[model samples]
Target: MFYAILAYHVEEAVAALTPEEDAALMTDLLQINERLYRERTLGPAARLGATQDACTLRGPGAGMVIDGPFAETKEQLLGLYVVDCATRDAAIAIARDLRRVNPTAVYEIRPISLYLPGVPFPVTPS
Candidate 1:
């Protein structure tokens, strides 16, 4: 299975929904999530926090931990969702479907590579 990254910017790309609208959209998102979950094709999906909640951790001379928000940009990364799929096209279709249902938001879809020391990445090149 291949893993996909669904990144979106809510504040900029989407308008705030009314209470009723919020409920409806959430229901739709939930339904989509349910379908993916039932198929066993879903891996771990999550909605990320603000970039300010981000931290940079890297090993320089020893190790470095810096605190601060992500650099300013045109838009902020508001959330993310990871899913397991059979192909990039499948993942792309899912993202497109999501966009159609949530026209208020703009999202990007990309596959990820996890190169563990021993374990192979979940996805392989086509």
Candidate 2:
């Protein structure tokens, strides 16, 4: 089995989620999390705040925590999901379902490279 990360992001959804929508989304997340828990494979990952809320490091031994980031870019990272699946398609399936929440919401689905002891990687044909 391999691991993958489903990075969820939104542009202006911050504090934009309606009370009902928020509750619904939370319920969906809980259901998914519970399924993953039962499977004992997939799992719920951490939810990181926006870059603006990040404690950024400027220079050596220098850093600061701010309310907003300097960069003015669209699509802010909302949250993420970690999964242990047999294939990328499986992970993509999960990511695809999340699209139901907000069709415009972006998700970066990337695999978590695994390097197990004594397991050799594939060799390319020269």
Best by TM-score: 1
How well does model 1 score by local distance difference test?
Answer: 0.67
Q: In terms of lDDT, which candidate is strongest?
A: 1
Query: Model 1: what TM-score?
Result: 0.68
For candidate 1, write residues 1-126 as lDDT tens digits: 556655555453344567787688778877888987897766666666556668877777868888855546566565666777779888887777777777756677776787222444575454
Model 1 bad stretches (over 4 Å): 12-15, 115-126
Clashing pairs in 1: none
Whole-model lDDT, candidate 2?
0.66
lDDT, each prediction:
0.67, 0.66
Backbone clashes under 3 angstroms, per model: 0, 0
Clashing pairs in 2: none
Write candidate 2's Cα lDDT for 36-70 as tens digits: 77977665465665566554446456565455655
